[model samples]
Structures are given as structure tokens and as C-alpha cells.
Target chain A: MIQVVVNFTERTYNGFMKVKQKLEILADAAKYDASCASSGTEQRNSRNGKGIGSTTGAGICHSYAPDGRCISLLKILLTNFCLFDCVYCVNRVSSNVPRARFSIEEVVQLTLAFYRRNYIEGLFLSSGIIQSPDYTMEQVVEVARILREEHDFRGYIHLKTIPDASPDLLARAGRYADRLSINIELPTAAGLSALAPEKDAGAIRISMAGLRERIDASKDKTASGKCPPRFSPGGQSTQMIVGADASDDRTILTTSADLYGQYRLRRVYYSAFSPIPDASPMLPLQSPPLIREHRLYQADWLMRFYGFEAHEIITSEHGMLALDMDPKTAWAIQNRAMFPVDLNRASKSTLLRVPGLGVRNVQRILTARRVRAVRLDDLVRMHAPVSRMLPFIQLPDYHPGATLDAASLPARLREVPTVPQQLGLFM
Target chain B: MHTVYLEHETDMEGWRYAARQLIRLEVAPQEVSWCVKSAREPGIQGDIFAMPDSRSGSDCSSQEWAISNHAGREVVGISQYHGKTDVTSSTIFPEQLAPSTHADHLMVPRQFIELARSVILHQAPERFYLLYRVLWRLQRERGLMRLAGDADVARLHAMTKSVRRDMHKMKAFVRFREAIVAGQPRYLAWFEPEHHIMAAIAPFFIGRFATMDWTIMSPNMGMNWDGDVLQFLPGGKLEALPAEDDSEVLWLSYYRHIFNPARLKLKAMQKEMPKKYWHNLPEAELIDSMIAEAGTRTQAMLQRAPELPRRKIIGYKRGPQRPDITGGNE
Candidate 1:
């Protein structure tokens, strides 16, 4: 059991600074981790708005982590201060951004304040590799241990792990956190060597593998046959800096698929890299296509939930995902030879391939089709934007065998990126 | 103290409706108490009793007098909920739509409920609302990323409470009940939701009852006239009703199924929907035990062990699969 508080040499460094200045410094530094979920726990106020509780905040934004759970997390870093220079990161030791560190008490205090005020439902906490991996990991575990044992808090918590943390520290973290993520930093081992020279990919994997072992070990039932203390019960997730490496969607997706198959990871977050505030000409001044990030998410979803394989959707000729039309639509246009699949007899997987047919819509069609053949009007009722699917699917009465076109599909759907290459938005 | 806007039914308010019934009970003048607050408050903390403006014949009759004497003038947004309870139930009032307690200082009029029910489902700038909520979810909830060190769950708990401060107006005040008028039964309810949701959600009721003529009353607000124009009213009091109950079972069935299974994370679910709310709603009975025994039940289901369904499986499936209920949410 954790003691109520850790008796640190209580340090109070007050910056007679304005809140906005502090926010500007903190928020700018906090970017990088991505896990925005306000779900998994719901508690309301007792009466008269008298107590501290809320189910009222906007909880969880659905972004795909690699294993493709619409992983939501409170993605922020503990402080921008770093002792190592990892090129892909803005918070690298050499960078000149202003840095601030939150005391564990202050951090805990802020989370509860925000929670009671209905600003958030959970905490996603990550930090720069401070003092040492073991020390930093210990501080992180202490927070979780205290939150659980001291406050009896049952809210969702996701921790961004430090590489090279001790096995004992990781095991303790598993007890309080709902999910733990160890950023791969970049895709290939060569990329890590070139960019973050001090970072070791092997060590990172070893930590992840260690986490997996402890998580597995904790699941061993207690002597009474009850489940032992939980270990990241929400499961493990990781992030990959999208544009930092030469990896394309296919390569990235292939790696993601392998990670999912091997680690049984809950998600893989693809964060499109943004140029650091300071100069580094070795890195591209231009941001990677943010829409590419969006497309990657779509393709990722398809592979995980919609039954599309990696190669079927990504061909060499179409080296990247289509910027204008969705990858699924583009795939349909290219595979016109398979067009006009009969909606009446199509399987759930085939129906999912049809544009405008979401999983929910597919379920509706499957159930409805069993009772009666679906006509275009019934499809309309299903809110299946028939125009999008019409060119691809064959309804009961209409068949468009001649309309399929594999040759012009690519040229018809090229799109220009919308924002600064980072995330497709001008801002 | 909260800023409330009390609404009245053109015909009756919870006050008038209950006054008529209290006229039937005879007892020694016992001081009566009524508690009320925006549905958002905790632990029934906002309850206030009003002693009537004057006593009728006896102590039991002072139910209204007691309520008004306590806090008749202080309550605001005292809108109506349309649900009804059996008269024999111990408390004469429920936070439901029907006014068991006849204190206007505490309860909303039926018309306020009608207006509220009319627009509860109308769409609004949900994204704008969502954007605000997302930020709260981030800084306030998950903490600005605490992986390398300590996390602050308490801070997250505090920030999440303020996000939906306005939703309480709908939950405590929504009044749904069945009533008959001009020889046909109409399912009607009243509420005082802040945003213009009536136009969006009324269709849910309309989709269910395309042929019925019912008015939803929201105080100092508007009401929906069946297939016609919306009716608006200001501050309101009490009235009585000749009522109906034809389609309640279908509504109950629909409510039972709207829950998402994959997202059935109870903490998340409870955070979005509080337990105090269960007392006033009909479906609470189905979920309460499920919530209490949630972990054990979940493990049992996962193990394919013999845990029972929420209710006995008499072999009936429920769905809101009407073909006309076409649109899905964003």
C-alpha cells in the first residue's frame, strides 16, 4: 500500500508568472503524447451540485492507436526538460523552448481540480526522461499508486512509459494505470540511430516486452482464485512519430499489423511530426501531410475492423493513400472488375467494402436482408449514401457492370493537402 | 442558489394538480417538506419544502403551505417532468413529470414540460460543445501527460464535474407521462433543457407517435403542438389531466437497448450518467443491480459462467428498429 504522500524535500519554486504564460510554456511543451479518453468511469453528483463529481465533460476523442482502438488519452508530457537530444522531438535536451515541471502534489491537485470541475474524466500523464529512467519511472508509479491507494480513485489513467525503467518500477506502474505506452520514437531501428542517437530501440523493446511480461504475470489469479492485482487492465498502447522516417502507409501499417499480432497491443498512435520551434535543417522544414495522418487512420481502421488486408489497399502505383477520396473508395474504383457485388447476397465483409456502409449500417443490412431483399429505397432508409455506394454495389434492380473503371480511378482522386503538412489544417 | 425559470401548463401546473388530490386526504396539520434542485446537483441536496400560502382544512392539507413557507419564491427554472406515480406511493411527489407535490415554488407546470419535451431532441452546435468538452477532457482529465513521473487522478476528477452543469435541467425536470384528450390517448412529457434540443428530439417522440396530438410544456418556454406550430408560455402553476398510457412499453424497450456494449465501461458510463438519476427514471431497476454487481457479472459473462441476464429471459427481444427511424448521430 502507498503511504498517503511521498515526503519529498517539498520544493516550492513560485514563478511570479501569469497563468497564461505558464500555460503557454506548459502546453507548448506538453504536446507529443496522444491518448484522449474520458471514458471507463462514470459518477454523478449527489444533489445540489453539493459534491465533487461529474459525467458531464466531453470524454474521449476517437483517434486510432495502431491496434486500432479509438484510443482516447490525455496526451501531455510532464515537462519539456530532457537530458538527451532526440531529433524528432521538440523537447530534446538541445531545444530552446521554455520548460516547467509540475510537482507531484501540484499535478495530483490539478488533476482532481480539473476532474471535479468537469473538465476531464481521467489522466494521461507522460514526461521527458528526467534525471534517470528509473527515478522518473518511480515518480510516475508513485503517483498512480497514491491515486489508487490514497484517494481510491477509479478513473481511467494512461501512462507514457520511460525507456530503461527498472522491472520493479514497471511492475508497480501496472497496478494503478489502465494502459501504458512506450513510444517507439520512430519506425525503423536505423531511423532511431540516425535521429535520436542516444536512444536504444532494443532497450525500448525490452521495456515493452518486460511490461508485457509483468502484465501477463499480474493476470495470474490469486490464491483464492480471484484475479490478482490488475496490470494496465485497459491494455498496452504505443505511438509512432509518423513523418519522421521514410516509412510509407503500407510499411507503417505492416509494422502496426505485426505489433498487433505479436504484442497483442491495444493501439498504435501515429503522431504526425511537427517541426520543432528551433532550427534543424536536417529535418524537413515542411510538415508531413497531416491528411496523410488522417488517411493512415482510415486505412488502419479498415485493416483492423473492416477486414481489408495491407497490400489490397496500398499498391506501388498509388504509393500513398489518396488525398481527395477515402482509401476505401479509391480501392473500389481500382478494383472495378469486382464491382456491382449484389447487395442482396453480399456477405457482411463485402457490404463493409461498399462506401457509405459503416459497420452499423452493415449490421442493419445483414439483419434486414434476411427478412427481405433490400431495394434502393430500403437502402436509402439505411442512410447508406447510395451515390457513393451505387457505383460500387449492385442493388436488387440496378446493375452497373459497365460503369466500373480501373484506369482513371487514380487521376480522378488526387487531393492537395489542406494545412501545413503536419495535420491538414492551416492552424 | 441557482437561477431557475419556472414554466406553467396552460391547463395545470404540478401545484394545481396536487392541490386537487391533497383535497382528498384528511389528517392532522403535519408540516410537509419538498426538495428540489437542478437535476445536476448531488445527493438530493437541493430539496426545499414550501408551506402553502394558507392552510385548507387540516394539517395534511398544509402540504402546499409547508412547501411555500419553506421556499416558494426562491426556486427558479422549476420546470415539469411528465411521468406519473401511483397515488398510493408514500410520497405524494416524485421528481417525475407529474406533480405529486403541489408546490409551484418547487415543481414546474405541465406546459413547461410539454415545451421542454418538444425540443429535447433537436440538434444544435454539438461540435462547438464537443470542442469545449475535449479541452476539458485533456488538461482537466488525463493530465498534460504524466508518464515519466506522477499522475494526478484527483485533479482529473475535479475538472470533469463542471462540463455538463446544464444537463441537470433536463434530467430532473423532464416529465414524461401518458394522458388522453378528445377521446384519444397521447404520450406527453415536459422538461426545461437549456439548448434548443426540443426540435431535434421531439421527432423521436413524433417518429414514435406520428398520429398523436400532444403538447410538451416548458415554463417561460415553447411547446410543440402536434404536426403544427410550437406553443410558447411564460411562468406557470398547476392543473389536472385526463390521461393515457398506450405506448410506454415501447419507449421503455427502446431505452433499454440504446446502451453501447463495447463501451460498457461502467466508470465511463457512470461518469456520463450518475446514479442519483436512477431513482427518478423507469429503467433504473434494470441497470442498478447490473451496476452494483458489474465486475463479478462481467467476469462471469466472459468466462461463460452461469450469470443471469438483467431480468429473467422470458424470451423476448427488444429493438427500436422501425424503418422510419432513419437518421443516426454524428
Candidate 2:
């Protein structure tokens, strides 16, 4: 009787510790990734009494972490064990961080449980390369496959794909995942090779190009007009580590613009390098360039939405974005000659270049002007920042006057330090 | 002067009936007052007892008073009981009143109707009066909505925006806790909303969580789904439902673990999930401890030295086999 009781206690303790340790290790290992978005997928729901979740066109942030990042998905690694020696990755084989691997069942149960509680939209399953990239890829895809097919979970699933995995494996991954991303890791091939010796930049691009082709083919219909099977209907996205290597903001933007054009990517996430537990002797021991990351996102918005080219936005001599001011305001001040853009006569593209007027306000202006002349009060009523707009735009009742030429324009344009300018709130 | 009492706070049909009658009677918007039957207005209540004096020959008949009261309206007297005959005077029917009317004759924009539908859901005592005022003005001013700067149009837009925001918040914040009801799994959630939006937002939850049995309770209303049909319940003080479950345990675990100690943007997190919501969220219990430990954890990571590498534990051998995509068919 004594022996049986002791064994039972021992087994319970081990089981409890193993799951808790695994969660701590795996979640810590996965936190460096910046992509927690669960948006831009095909809208689906399980209203037929078959499944338990739904995905709308726009994703909802179930919670917000103190990192200011959204917690829309239960982002985690299938396992933290790795064979690759990516120096920047805390999960890299060379690192001394304690490792753990979650069983496939644990992952599925965790996702479903978290989802049922409305803690998450779905799973974003990633893994460190274990055994081989192919083996690791298969393990990751199996989690998604089980959640989608066996459980009939109609929620968002974003799988991180290994570029080295076989095309066949990639194809199957596309079938199950709403989104697939392969990290570019670094901006330049030299930077990538120097830091992550095992990763090949060429191979990553090849996989991206392959993914894009398959994504495009799936979207196209055959001559019979039959729709092809859905393959990543949410499209593809990629992430690049900003401060880990020697690449500057200009280089990063160039790579991002290229990726957006080449891969038809939905988003390019910039993750500022967070120093991990074990220090790399060669990397800089400074604060993570968070402001730089924020500015890059702003610059990216300009490129995608405002029609600003990558070459035009970079102002600092070092090819780095200005830390104090937003890229749009910096560009507007740099080209002061384009100031006092006539709100009545300026084209959509020119109006978009204004610092304060966002894409929505500009569209509203164009639409409203067709009906009647837009005054300053009309702009204010639309909730446009009149203080920011007064320096750059001319309305029927108001103009910049001499303020456009004032030397304090840059200081005035600079965002007040205390206020948090949320990036996507304007649009 | 005229008084129209609505049967329900959010009763659009009742509102439309009163509006059409008032317009037909040539009663200008300022000449009429609109109040809900259940609204807590003492003046409206006193107006009901005062109605007996306006009756022609009845000796304070309680039945006549009951019909006249309609939760209290002084001007709408015993004639309310004999409605179709007593109130239908040729003078009450304007020359423009036609059984079949054109949309152009109303001159109210389709936009104003959409705005009114959302605005009427608001709990403001003046909402009905404000909407009627806008509708009355729209007939004279065709381009009223186009003036986004106009106070009435702007107020209309503001109310609609507030209701829409509440609906979106409901969509984002409702957290369901799994419970066993009748030996079957049912999800229960409690939410506090600032507006009368439970009816407006229930269909979204029904459509989303259709397969699962669930109940969403708010201060104003409650909605329940039983796999096939959805039912509404009058809401009061919410009884403490099952607050903890195995699923919530894992959810809280994930929440505690997923937060990065390095980045502490408390303002941003609070901006989205305000402290008011933090009380109900299972994960929110971890937030204070997470914030407290974040700085120290970040410092420790920053200060830790490069430890000597441990012997790597070998997992699967990289065999000659490539991952077969065809394997998925099974």
C-alpha cells in the first residue's frame, strides 16, 4: 500500500512539472517573433454545429500584451529543440537555454482550450528546426492538420514554414494554414551568412517565390471556371530582424518593398532584436531599436498606402529613419517646396503626402469637395488634426500663410512626446 | 401640443407609427413630445392622473384613465380608447396625406433612416425627440446629412458611432467560460456594456458560436443559444456563473507565459483592454505580477553571461527520406 501511494504521488508530480516547464520554456522561446496577427483570411464560421470557431475578414485582438503587440493568436513553438545554429535565436542549438518539446496532442488541446475560452483566435504554430527541416516542417503541419480536419476548427492558423522543406511539404502546409511565412532573417545575404551560418538567403527567396506561385495558381480558376482548392487565401507575409545585423533602415525598406512586389506579401513585420538570456559576444549590447522599428512601420505604410517610393523616405545621412519625427512629416519638411498643398486642387497622391491628413481624411476631402467647398471647420468636424494640417494644407478659409516657411516647422511637426500615436488608428 | 408615448424603448415600429401620425396631423416637431412608457419621468406620470379633467362625461372612469395614462400622458385622453374614430378628423389629415406616398415626398435621406435606427437604440431620454427633430428638418432641408458640420447631423453621427463602437467592443471583449449544463457543455459569458446594445449585438454571437450552447449576460439583457434556437431573457443582477474551468486554466497559463518581459507598454495594453475589463479576464489576474517581474526579468536577461554550451540531446536522425506530401492523403 505504501509503495503504491509513493509511486502515484511521484507520477503526479512529474506530470504536473513537465507540462508547466514545457509551457514556460516553449512560450519563452517563441516570444521573439513579432507576428501575432490573425487577420486577412477568408471569412469562415462553424454555424453548422460542426465546429466551434469563426474568422471574420478583420481579425479581433482578444487581448493586448504590454509589448503593445496584439494577442490575437496562441502563438507558440511546437518544440524549442533545434539543429540550426542561428546566433540571434535563443532556441538555436548553440544556446544554453533549457529546451522543451510539446506533444502534438498537448498543442491541439491547448489551442482548442484557449480558443474555447475566447483567449485566442487560433494557433500560430512555429518550430525550431529539429532533426531536419523537413521533419520539423512535417511536425508543425500535423498540428494544423489535426486542428483543421479532425476537429473542424474554422479559425485562423498561421504556420511558419521552413524554406529548406520540400515543395510537396510546403504544398500540404499551404492547404491547412490560412497564412504561411518564412523569415528573411536578415536584409542582405552577407548579413544572413555572417549571423546565421546555416541559413541560405537564396533558398529562402526560392521558397518565397515558390509559395507565391502556388498562392497565385490557387487563386486562379481553370478554363472550366472551377475554383481551385484554397491555398493560403489570406496570402503570405515575411519578417526581418532589424538590429541583429548591419543592415540599415534603407536596406530593410528596399528588401521589404522587393518582398512586397515579388511575393505579393500581405505584410512585412519588423522585429527589433531583443537581447536574449545568453549574450552573443559580437552583437551590440544596447537597447533594442524600438523607435526605429515603429518608424519603419510608418515608412512601410507610406510605401504601401501613400504611394511613397522606398528611395524617397530615408532622410538621415546613415540611411536610418529619423527617430523623433514620423517618416511622412520628415519627408514633407525635407521637400518644403511641395507645401501648402491646395486641398481643393491637389490630386489624391499629393494630398496623401500631407503629414496630418491620413488616407481616410483625404478620401473624405475629395468626396466632400465634389459636393461643396471644404472649409477648415469641415476638416475639423471630420476629426482631422487641424494643428498638424494648418502647416501643410490650404483650405477655403485657411492657409499656411507664412507658417509654411517658418523655421520652427519641423519642431511644430514633431509629435508631442507624451501622446502615444497609434499607427493604424488614423486609417 | 401633443404627446406620443412609445411602447418599447427600442421599438422602431412604435416610433414609426407615432412619427407618421404626427407628420400627417401637421404637428411640428417642437409641438410634440415623445416619451417611452417605462421612462422614469414624474411629470409624465402626473400628467396621467390629470387626464380625468379633460374627459367629457365619464365620472372619473378608471378604464378611461388606464387607456389615457399609457404610462402617463395628460393630453392623449379618453379618446385614446376610441382611437380610430375619435382622433381621425379631416383637419388632422393634411392635404398632402396620401395612402401611397413617394419616398421623395418624405424627402428624408436613406442615410437618415439608417442613422435613426442605430441612434434610437441609445438610452438618452431625448433620443426619440432628437431623431424626430432630424426627420422633420430633413423634409425641408434635402441636403441636411451632407452638412457633416451641422450640429444635428453631427449629433446623429456621434450617437450612431457610439453604438457601433459598443457593438465592436462586445465582439472583442466577451470571454466565455465553459460550463456543464444538463450534462452537456455550455459556454457562459458576462459582459458589461455602456449602452443598450445587447439586442443589437446578440446576432453576431449567435452566428459565430452557433454550434456551441452559450449564454451572454449583460446588465440590460441576456441571450442564450441551445444549438438550434436562440432565446432572450430579461437581465438583472448577474448570478455568479462558473468562473473557472480546465480550459481557462490552460488559457491563463498561455497568457502568463506568452507575455514578453522585455517590452512593457502598459499604456498600450490598457488602451485596448482597459482596467475595467481586467477584473473579469482570467488572464488579467497575471497582469500585475507580470508587470512587476518584467523589469527584473529583462535586467536578468540583459546581464546574464554566455554560459558554456551543454551537450546537445540528439532527437531524430536526419534520414535519407524526404517528407512525402502524398502522405497527407491517409
RMSD of each: 23.9, 7.8
**A31 in model 1: Cα distance from truth in Å?**
1.3
Model 1, A40-114: lDDT tens per residue?
A: 332322222222222323344322211122233334455656766677676666656567776675556555433
| Top-TM-score candidate index | 2
Q: Clashing pairs in model 2?
A: A66-B265
Cα displacement (Å) at residue A272, model 2? 1.0
> TM-score for chain A of every candidate model?
0.83, 0.93
Tens digits of per-residue lDDT for model 1, B181-268 = 6676443554444444443434333332233455665443434455443443332322432232222322233223222121234554
Error of 2 at A219 (Å): 1.9
Candidate 2 residue-wise lDDT, B1-330, digit = tens: 455555445767667766765544445655555655442211122332232222222211122111111212233322332344555332221122334342435565788889988998776657777787777776666667776655677788788888887777678778888878899999998988876777777667766777888888876567788988877665645565774565565566667778878778888788888888776676788888889998999899888877766876443333343333223323
Query: In candidate 1 chain B, where is summed lDDT lowest over 10 consecutive residues?
Result: B2-11
CAPRI-style grade of the A/B interface in model 2: acceptable
Q: Runs in model 1 with CA error above 4 Å?
A: A1-23, A39-75, A216-224, A406-427, B1-330
